[model samples]
Target: MKVPAPNDDRKGGRVPRWLRILLPAVLIVVWLALAGVGGPYFGRVSEVSSNDQASYLPASADATQVANLQAKFSGSDAVPAIVVYERSSGLTKDDLAAITDDTKDIADLPGVHGDVSPPIASKDGKAAEVFVPFADDSDLDTNVAGLRDHLSTSTPDGVTSYVTGPAGFTADLVAAFGGIDGILLAVALAAVFLILVVVYRSPLLPILVLATSMFGLCVALLVVWWLAKWGAVQLNGQVQGILFILVIGAATDYSLLYVSRYREALRDEQSRWRATWIAIRGAFGPIVASAGTVIVGLLCLLFSDLNSNKALGPVASIGIVFAFLAAMTLLPSLLLAFGRAAFWPVRPKFGSEHPQVVGPHAKGLWARVAGWIRRAPRIIWVVCTIALLLGATGVLQLKADGVPQSDLILGHSDARDGQQVLADHFPGGSGSPALVVGPASELQPMADVLLNHDGVSSVAVVAKDSPSGTAPVTADGVQPVGAPGSPPPEPTTVDGDVMLQATLSDPADSDAAEATVRSLRTDLYKVDDGILVGGVTAVAIDSNDASIHDRNTIIPIVLVVILLILMLLLRAILAPVILVLSVVVSFAASLGVSAYVFDHVFGFPGADPAVPLYGFVFLVALGIDYNIFLMTRVREETQLHGTRQGILRGLAVTGGVITSAGLVLASTFAALGVIPILFLAQIAFIVAFGVLVDTLIVRSLLVPALSYDIGRAIWWPSKLWRTDAAILASDSDPERLVEEQIDAIGAGGRPSHHHEHLHQGDREHPAP
Candidate 1:
């Protein structure tokens, strides 16, 4: 009496059927519980999220240091909202009286800091601007929205009121990201659902796949929310939106891969439990490798100097972790519970042929792809590589210096409009000033340095003795703003330092303003090394410079890190090198195409430097996933069949699944286009297009053809390089081995017992 092998017995035949059922039930219940808990955290994310520029700056940045020290000098951290009232004609008495009344009322509003600046007439007198300061702890967007409503009602007729400044811009930015938790996510899910329903052609299967993704996202969010709350990580609107899309796309892709394997296994295995186990074993390597690659690649962002970039690294990695977990555990459990019935109209039948596979031959579009690859491997790779290289030439057009804050929000923006009005009549940096902090004794010298700069329209020092918050400073010194006999107002000193606010002639968000601030800071630092420059313009300059530094520093590190991961996963130096190069080429091409689109089509302002950094992280990391999916299968199949045949078989078998995964990822990322922010939109296009390129061209044509041409040497330095022929011969003949194992199970006998019988018959009459 021979016992069946471990593989046969483990699939409910040996293990109790009750345990199998219980396991899936438990998993489903756990995931449902996790989803329930995480679903509510969406709205609560703002509790921990911040858009404060200083918070995201590098610690050592002069702006960051000044931001910290400047906070100590003030009672509260305040953002100024510049309210500009304009009319074609000079302001009438009624308009001036209305503006004065509005200022008084604004000072009483919640979150208002100090006194609202009395309406200061613009040089043209056609416009008057009021500066309203909002405290740091306030809900800035809410307060600004309320203020807008108030202005609409309080302002005199024929005078249009526009809010523009740091506070106004922040409100617009926050409002732009407002859709992330609702519309962005809903659209992404709906798109994925439609795609899944079409791909599986089964109502129940799509639900299971979506459930796995939703639950994965929920759990990942739950963890991230707490992590952010505890200050273990930082959360922002941009990062939050990416996290939701990335997790959903990644989980669904992993689920699809597993579903495909489970469906294939169901054709041979009699028991659902057995098929699920077999599917898990078959899918485990690629799923883990793919997720690991993405996780490690994202984590490479830790090297970034910008806190936002560094924060995204772990935040997104955590999302990937849960996505992998849900795909492996929750999805498998759902499929196991549903069994063959999950497919509904098109169920996988035991002992029936896999639909994509015809008797003794693979037949389909993928097969044709394989045939074409076999016909001209070198031509296919060379042509595809050159085309990608040509597309990559567009990388020269990418303008990643940085974008003005006014352009940060797409579509209508009152703040941006107000900035234009203010620039037309008043010093462009009317409400927002570049702040300089230095030794109290050096205040006069720092103020002199600021006054002498070409960019400086005026300079003032905070003076405690003045009724107004500040006293004007000329090249000579701080000029008293009081009555003639009053002693010169003393500059307010905090610790040993005094603050000077420099007004710029250019718009605070303009490149000219940044250049001016850069020069002023350079000159002031020479006068007093302790002098620190910060404010809206300085923050922008510093942030952009840091982002550029991060882009340069982190891109190479990410590349090196991902290359090493590929090397370990493939266990071949040459293949990893080739894959890294392929993805880098693919990324460049995607960026090139995006640059053209942004310039000629979208007419977008130059990209933020971080845009390319983010694109590289997502494209290369995610791009390598498809290659991993294909090459791992090739490596697996190569162990059974020779390398050349293995490449063909691997491409044919994995084509539909990998392509579907790529489409799903692309679609989800494309959903980000709905958000209307430049950075996310650019990223959405680059990564989505890059994935398709990898799926259609690189993975389908280039990688397989190149690998086929290289043959077994693709696995160079691996022991398989020397032992390929022997491994191919003694792999128990994969086709015969499967038949023998099935027969042994049917006979209730050991695989050893039926091995010779199957081998002898296979030798006598081989498969086509």
Candidate 2:
């Protein structure tokens, strides 16, 4: 009985190409359907940060009050503009009237919040804050920016208005994305295109490269959307943006290894289909192995204690798998159909017997650099070790923040202007930061100490105040649930509870802001035993704690997962172990460098809490990818040549491909430096630079030297290695071997003349 290999043609003859062409199409269609059906569901779950977290705690509202408040301060639309007016002299009747007119205009704006605060002329009349709220679904930035610009240039005579608070932050976000983000995207695109063009050597090739990656990205996001809507995942806009770049850049990289080899096959065979099969067959082990390593790395995110990290891992893994699927199936089918003709005007002959050295021409400047390292591998290792050590010194200095965007409008911005006015009249906290008031007994002494804190500028004790407002109580009121005697409810009172404005010493993004929060908490715990230290900063700290806790847990889990996968793929105990170790070292080195670049070089607000975590994941996972690519060559060498000679030859053949992919990946990532969101751009640079180093320095030199040093011990008594020994004894015909793919010209455009049968079907690229 003949065993059918899905990957290869049994007789090296014609095979139906339906699955190869159609499976990817079906996946893409299914992915699109999933996205359409599931977008809103995931979107709702994603609103946790903006919804449930934003809702009040420790109280249950009656339906009426729930509806009232739901419509009132519900969603993100509440607390729009707290317009402030300032003048040296106390407010005159004219100034007050002018302020009133502006409030009317703001309140009347589309999607404007109901019940605007009356003109709050200051006690001394020199300043006043007018509260203007808006609807949750409103485009706060658009309206606020327009208003701010209008008010800045057209303040009514002596009266000046400034808008502040959440509206201001929203405006800032819009501006940041609009202004610097475009440049970053463009740079990233240019970098990716340039790298792909140089590597693939065709203008059309880079577009295909990106298209394949984009297809992967779209499918991964669709899966995430499906799972997220059903409450299986969680995401935020930042995650979306980050995933976009990661999937595209990463998928392209994964394809590079296979495609480059395919092109090489074409050059040797001269028959496009023949070379395509050869390329596909030859690349099977290394490509799958490399992908498995990446998948394992991404799966590590599943262990994230943070729901975000956990979700991120699965989503990313989907991307890798789909990309792998696309490469192995979609790419192969396309190549088979087009053949060498895809290369068009150039057939990629490169002479009958190309120079063996891969010298200075298309070989890149790195080959010369590698040659230098090969001559003095020990010295190279010493220098690199020292350099990486120095780079890593900055890791110790890394700090974490939950919300780290620079989201503040200019002095003339609507929100900023509104905020300045509010601050000048009332306290800054009067605008943002909800006061989570509870009973005196519930908070202990926290209230008293917080009242006296230097940052506390105002106090609002709503407990003793009676609500006689004819302003129509929209209160559906809280349900009198779990009441022992069902005490009759009157006007809500907690006089014993303290409502105090807790100010900060600096901007939250600054070092001092975090320090202030820390110091305040310490002082609260020291004196005010009853206080809970509750508010945005408090939530931030909790989230940060969660982030740190998750990182500590997830890293080990991910590493172990990746190691296990490597063990299976390589079928070697020692080889997989060393590969994991080398990759780990490279990851640590990359993180240290990332910290330096972001925290020291560019001086960002430290690393994004997620930044180091991503560095570890990508560096180790993708680093192993290159390791697999290089190690396959080394393994082939050992099988054909001895350890030393094989290592040298493998490096010579595969080194250029690895370096080209790295350059392209790095450049794509480096483009992030141009992104408006400072942290994201920083992340791009860090990851990009890490990829470059992984290819140019680590894989090209250090790994080869180590492989040379290891010899047969790299495989260390694996059954597969033993089986290979048996194959050596029988001297299996190289051309007759049943590979997973029919040998053909690869993406590298190589050619081959020998005939063979290629019998494979849907099993190679299954749809359902």
Query: Residue 590 of candidate 1: its Cα lDDT?
Result: 88
Can you write out model 2's per-residue Cα lDDT over 1-768, one digit (the tens) per residue?
Answer: 877644334544555466555644665566446545644443333333222222212122121122233232222336455567777767788777776776666666665666676776666678887666655542555666676766676566776666665555565545554432246445666778887777667766677667666666656666666665576655544455556566666777767777777777655565455566677788888888877777777777765545556666776677677778767765665556666555555556622433333222214444465456445657766676566667667667666555432322222244544554554565445544323343445332454554556655433322212221111111232223233555322323234543333554333333444555566667765754443444444444544565676678778887888778777776678887877776666666766776666655666655546667777777777777888887777676556534444455567767777777778667766665554555566567667777877887678776766654555556766754554444332223222322212343333433332122111111121110
In the range 333-444, model 1's lDDT, one tens digit per residue, is 9888889999998898876754432112446888789878877889999999999999998899899998888898889988899999999989988888899988998877
What are the runs in model 1 whose C-alpha is more than 4 Å off? Answer: 1-12, 355-360, 727-768
RMSD of each: 5.2, 9.7
Cα lDDT computed for each candidate against the true fold: 0.85, 0.57
TM-score of 1: 0.93
Winner by lDDT? 1
Provide the TM-score for each candidate, comma-separated: 0.93, 0.75
* Model 2, position 592: C-alpha lDDT score: 73
Overall local distance difference test of candidate 2: 0.57
